[model samples]
Target: MSADILNSLARRVGDGVAAVRPAAAMADSEATDPVEAVATALLGYVSEPGDGVLGRLVGALGASGMATALLEGRSGRDIAGQAVTGLGPADAPSGREVTAGLARWGPRLEEDAFARSIAQAARVGARLLLPGDGDWPEGLDDLGVHAPLSLWVRGRPSALAERPSLALVGARAATGYGEHVAVEAAAGLVDRGLAVVSGGAYGIDGTAHRAALAAAGTTVAFLAGGVDRFYPAGHEGLLGRIVETGAVVSELACGAAPTRWRFLQRNRLIAAASDATVVLEAGMRSGSLNTAGHAAALGRPLGAVPGPVTSPASAGCHRLLREFDAVCVTDAAQMAELVASVGGGVGGSGDGDDDAMTGAPPPRRLEMLSSAERRVLDALGTRRSRPIGDLVRDTGLTPGAVMGALGALDATGLAARSGEGWVRRPPDEASVRPGSWS
Candidate 1:
C-alpha cells in the first residue's frame, strides 16, 4: 500500500515543519506534521475535487511525493508511469488522460496561492485533517479515488466524526412547504442524536442547519468554496454560528471561489459523509437530486418528502420517489426510520435487524433515471398523446431538454412515439398493475 511513500512523506513533512518552527514547540500544539499539511494545502490549490488522476497518483506516491513531482514540473506521462508501477495494471490512468489533467492543473499552480491558503487557515484557527487524522470522516473513504486530498475545518471536528450523520438537501428556491419540512426533518434527526449535514446554500440547506442548531444538535456544512470565504454572502451570520457550534468544512483551500462545477462535485461529499440523504423539496432540475443520486450510487439509503403534485418545487422529490426508489418520508419519525434501517440499529433496537423484527419490506430497484427523463415521463398521459411543445410547457422544461428526455425514454421502452405524438407504455407483463391511474 505504498508504505515507503507514506513514511517518507511523514518524515519530510516533519522535517519541513521543524525547519519552519521549533520542533519542540510545534510538537505540542499541532495535530499534523507541518510539511504534509503544506503539501496537501498546495494540492487543493491546483487540483479539483474528484480528480481521479490526482487521487490515484497520491495513493501510489503519497501526498509528499506527488507534490514534489508536480512542483518540479514533471510531465503527466512520467507521473502516470510511476503510478502504474505501484498500482494494479487495470487501475492505472491512461497517459492521455493524465496529460490532459496535468494541463488543467498547471495553470492553477502558484506557490503564493498555496502560502496564502495556509496562512489564512492559521489566522482563522482552522485545522488541516489528512487521511489518517483522528477527526477525518471515514465515510469519505467510500468514495475511493474521488475522496478529498485533505479537509480544511473550522469548529469541532468531532461534529463530523463522532456521530451518525444525515444529509438534508433541496432547492435553493425552496417554497414554504419545503422549508417547513426541512426544519422539521433537521430538528427531528437531531433529537434522534444524529448530526445533520448539508451544503451551506439558502432555502432548504440553510433551514436545515438553522433547525439543527436551534435544537442544540450537531450539524456540519460542506462548502463548495473555501471555508475562508463563505458563498451566498447572505449566510455569513448563519455560517458564523455554524463555526462556533458545529463545523464548516471544505475540500478547497482558503482563497478558492465557488464555481458551478465545484458545487456539483461538492454534492458527493455531502452524500459520502452521511449515513443517509433526504430531499425535502426540489424542482426537477434542483441540485439536491444530484446529492440523492450520489447517495444511491454509494449504496446509502435515500429518502424524499412528498409534496403537492401541483407544486413544481417538489417535482424532484416526486421523481426520486417514483423512479429512483427513494423511500417516502413525511416527518422526523420516518426520517429516523430510514437512518435506522441503513445504520443496522438505532437507540436500543436489538441487533440492528429491526426490519426483520418489524417485517418491513426490503428496498426495491437499486437504480433510477435522471430527473429530466422522469419529468418527461411524468408529463405524458397514460392513454393520450402529447407533442413535444405541449410537454415543454407542462413540464416547464426547455424544448431541447424535453426532446432529449423523450428520446431517452423511448429508447428505454418507457415511452413510445404514436401517430399523434407520444404516449406512456403499458406496464410490463411481469409486474403487478395498479387498480387505476389518477
Candidate 2:
C-alpha cells in the first residue's frame, strides 16, 4: 500500500471541496447539487502552498485536462489548483477568497456530507479503498476526474487488484437469452479463476451472480445505491448469496437510493474498476452503453455479446460492435481470452482457471437423458424445489411430460416427490428424512 497515494487523494479531494466552499454553503442552505458544490470547493485547495499557484494551476488543467495529467505523473495538487485558476476571475476563486474561506469553513468541509458518506460506508462491512491502497486497481486511476475518491467494498478487498475482473452489464429487463449468456459467461469466467463483477441489478446481473455461486466461484457485484439496499427487489436472494460467497460493493454509502445521476456515475465505477466490461444485452438506449463508453474512453478492454438481430434488447450491443469498436464475444472462454490479451496485460490465472463452468463432468453416453429427463434436471439444477405446476411452467412442457420426467427422476433416485413439493434428493440420503422436505 502506498500511503503517499492515499494522502495525495485525501488532500486532492479535500481541496476540491474547499474550492467550491461558497457554492457548497449555498447549496446546503438552498438544497442543490451538494456533490457538485463540494467538487467546486476543492478547486483552489489543490494548489501548491503559495498565493498565485491556484491561478497558474487552473490554466494548465484546462489546457491539458488536469485529471488525465494527474494520472500521467503530474502532481495532483499542483494540477488541480492551477487548472481552476486558468479560467480567470469569472470562473475561479481569487486567492484571497480561497484563503479566507479556507480559514472559516475548512473544518466544515472535513465534516461535510461527503465525508459522512465515507464514514457511513465504513460503518458497514465496507472498507474505504483510497488510491495507493493495496486493493486499489491502478488501472482505475485512468479515469482521471471521474475516478472515485474511495471505493466502498465488502469481501476480499484484495480481489479489486489481485484478480482479473470482468464487468458483465445488461438491461434490468433481460430476456431468457440474455440471462443464459450472463450465467454461462459468469460461470466460465469463474471457472477460469477470474472474479466476475456486475451491477447486481436484476435479470442478467442476478443470473450472473447465481451462476458464479453455483460454480462455487468468487463474484462481486457493484451497486449504484448501497450494500444494504438491493435494487429491482427481485434479486435480494441472489444478492445475499453474493455477499456470502464473494462481495457486494458500492461507491456510495448506505441509505443512498439509486438515483439517475448515481446510476450514470455507477457506470464509471464498473468500467474503471474492471479489467474488461462486457455488455450482454442492452436495449437501443440501454444505460449499459454508458458503462461501455466509459470503458472505451479509459482504453479498457470492452466486449459485447451478440444477440438476435430481432431482439431490441440486443440493439445496444450491436451498436457497440458497429460504432464503438468493441469485441464481439460468444462465450466465457472467448471473453476471458479477449480481455486477457486485448489490453496488453495478462489476465489473472489461478485454481479455477481450468475448472469447467458446469462444475460437473460432461454428460457421458449414459448420463445423457431424454428431453423430458433433461427438462426435469434443468429445473432441479436451477431451483432445488418446485411444485408440479411450477415445473410445468418453467420447462414449458405439458403436465404429462413433467409427470413422466419426475417419475423417471424418482425411480432413478435423483429426485423425490413430497407433500411440500418436488425436490432434488440429497446424494447420500437413503430415504427422505423426516421434515427434510419441510
Candidate 3:
C-alpha cells in the first residue's frame, strides 16, 4: 500500500468529518490528529475488524507504528518480533500467528481500494472517530485489543455519546409477538430518555429501531459491514431514516461486505457499545443469542423477553433465563432495570449460536449439529433449492465442509435433496418467514 495515497485519502476523510460535525460540535477532546487518522485508516484497510494479530500489534505499537511497519513491507516474523517486546510474551501473537494474519490481510492492501473506501465514506457524509475522539464511546474500550481501531459514523456523531445506550436485538425472522414486544420495549426505553442500539437488520432489530424513531428518541444501529452499504438491501430506507437523527456505526472500512464471520465479530461491538442487551425474541439458534453471549462475556447485564414456551422462536430467550441467568424482562421498565438493577451476567456462546444478534450453544434440539452444519443451515433456502456450491459460497465453507454439513442437515430432517440441490425442511414447528439474520 502507498502511504502517500493512504495519507491523502485520510486527509480527505478527516476534512469530511470536520465538515459534517464541526470542531465546536466535537466533545471537549483534543483535535483529531491527521497523522493518527491516516494510520488508523491504513490499519482498517489492511485488516478486518477484530483481527487478533493486527489488534495486538496496534495496541502495542499504536496505529501509526503498526501501519508504518506494514507499509514498509516488514515480514510478519519481524513485526511479531517488535510486538512481543511491547506486548510481552503472554499477550503477543506468535510469529506463525502474525504470518497467517498477514496472509489474510495482504491481498486487500491496494491503494485504489483505500481511495474507493475514503470516497464512499465522504459520499455518505460519515465522520471518522479515532480512539480518543470525544464522541468515541468509552464502552468499546472494554474489548481491549478487540476494540475497533476507528469507527465510521453517519448522522449526529454526538448521538453515540449523548446518553446511556441499550442494545435490543433478536431474530430477523421475528414473530409478530416478538415485534409487538420489541416495539413496546424500544419505545418505552426511548421515552425514558435512553439511546437504543441494535443491528439494522429486518425483523426484531428493525422493529426496535422503528419504534425508537417513532418515539423521537436517540438510537444507534451497529452494522456488520461498511456503513456506506446497508446489508439486507430492504432496510436501506430504515437505515437512511436512522442517519437522519441517530447515528449508524461500523468498524469495517467503507468497501467491506458483511459475511458470517464478520457478523459474529460485529456482535461484540453492539454489546460493548451498550450498557445492557435485551433479547426480544430468538429461536434456539437465533443470532440474538450470540449478542447475548457477548453481553454476558462483557459482564453487561442481559435480559430476555419471554414468548410462549410452545414457540420455538423463544427457545433461546428461555435458554438464557434458564441456563445463562439472563434477567427475565417483559417490558421496557424491566429491560432498563437489567442495567440498573443487575450487576453482571455469567456464561455465554456455549456451543455455536452465531450472528443476527449473535452467542450461545446450539439448542438441545439441534445439539448434534456441528458449527459447520449450523452455518450451512443458516445459508440454506427455506423453499428455494440451492446447490452445494451456493451454500459453500454463501457460508464461506469449503466444498468438503459444505457436503458434510449437508449430510448432517439431511439426516436431521432440517434439509433435504431437491433436484440436485437442497431446501430447508420445515421442523415440527412452522418455518419462519425468511429474511436476513446473519
Candidate 4:
C-alpha cells in the first residue's frame, strides 16, 4: 500500500501488459505508454473527477511524469512546483491548493487497492483510455483542467469518438411523457448519424439508451461508479447490451461505488462528452439540472422539452427554459436542429440563428429578441423614425423600457437613429447573425 509498493506493482503491470500484447501497443500508438496507463489507472482510483491540481500537474508534466512523481512520494505542492516551473502564469493551481489537494488524495493512495482494481478492470474486459488515445472523445478537451484523469471504458472504445454525441438526461422518476420524448429524441439523433450519451440511470437515461439501441445506434453510458459494477442493478441487461453495441464508461476504477458527489461529477462527463444536452423532464430539484448546468458552463447547446405547466414533474425543464436560456425543443426535428447548431458554438439557447451559418436564411431574428426589444422594433416603422416617447406610447411600454429596447437593437445594428428618433433596420440587415446576440 506504500508508494514503493505501488511503484513496483505499476512497473510490473505495465511491463506485463506490454509484453503480453505487443499488438495492443502497436494498434494504439497512444496506448504504447503502458506505464502512463498504469499511473492514470491508479490516479483514477485515488482522485475524483475534475481534480484541478491533478489535471494541472498532468497537463504540465504529462501523465507519466505526474504518476512517477506521485509514486515517488512527491507532495502535491512539490508536484505543482515542478509542473509550473516552465509554464506561463495563468490560473494554474497555487501551492496552497496543491497542498490541500495532496492532503485529500494522500489517504486514498492505496497501492494494493489500485492494483486490484486494475486487475478487476482487465478481468471485466475494460480498458484504460488516456488523453492521447484515438478513442478519447475530443469534446472533453473543452473541459480543460477539469477533464477526467483517465477513462475506464468497457465495450468499443472507438464508440466514444465515432460521431458527435448528444446528452439526453432527465428525472429518474420520469413521467411517461418524459420517457417518450427522450426515446424519440435519442432515436432521431441516431438516425441523424450522431451518438447518444447519458448517465445510464433509470427513467429517462435508461429509456434513451434503450431507444438508441432499438434504433441500432451507438449510445454511451457514463457511470458514477466503476464500469465493473453498474449502478441501478436493474439496468444490468441494458448495460450489457451497451457494452456490446457501444460502451459503458467511467472515470472511477473497478470496485468503486457510486456516491452522491461522484454522480454529480459523472454528470459533467455526460455533458462534456456530448455536443448538446437535452432535458426531457425534471423536477424543481432534479439532478438532471446539474447536468444541464455543466452543459451550459461548457457552452454546449442545451434543449428542454415542455410539459403540462400543471405537471410538477416538468418544473425543472420549465426552470431551465425560463431561467437558463435553454432552447424549447419539443420533437426530434427540433432536437436535430439544436445539434446542428452545436458546431456554431451555440450554447443551449437554441435561438435558431445558427441555421444561417449553414446557408439557410436565418429565421425571424425577432423571435430571439427580448420582448421589450421586439415591441420597440414593432413600434418603429421601417422607413420612418419614431421618437422614444412615440415608441413607448405605441408599444404601451414605459419610456425606460423603450429606451432599453432601442439600445439593445442599436447595439446589434437592428435599429438606427435618424435625426432625433429611431427606425427599424432593414430586414436584410436585421437578419440573425450566428453567435452575435446569443
Top-scoring candidate (TM-score): 3
Model 4, span 373-435: residue lDDT tens: 765775677887798656654444456657888888999888898988988776553465322
TM-scores, one per candidate: 0.74, 0.56, 0.79, 0.74
Clashes of 4: 2
Instruction: State the lDDT of candidate 3 residue by residue for 250-316, as single tens digits.
Output: 8987877786556777888988988899999998777788788889888888999889989999988
Per-candidate Cα RMSD to the true structure, in Å, reads 12.6, 21.0, 7.4, 18.6
- Residue range 125-193, candidate 1, lDDT tens digits: 676767766667888999888888888788887687855778899889889999988888888787777
Q: Order of candidates by TM-score, top first?
A: 3, 4, 1, 2
Whole-model lDDT, model 1: 0.74
List pairs with backbone clashes in candidate 4: 301-348, 302-348
Q: Which ten residues in a row are the worst by lDDT in model 3?
A: 346-355
Clashes of 1: 1
Q: How would you encode candidate 2's per-residue C-alpha lDDT over 1-438 as one tens digit per residue? A: 333433444564453333322232233232233232333223312211112333333344431243234323444444445546656556554444434323322222222454545444445555544454555667767655345544556666666675677888888778999998887888888877777777877667778878888988778887766665676577877877777767777665445556443555566677777888898988765667777877887777888999999988898889889988889888887789766785434444433320011111111211334645755655664245688766654443456667888888788777886666788764333432211000
Residue pairs in steric clash, candidate 1?
Answer: 344-352
TM-score, candidate 1, is 0.74
Positional deviation of residue 26's Cα in model 3 after best superposition, in angstroms: 5.5
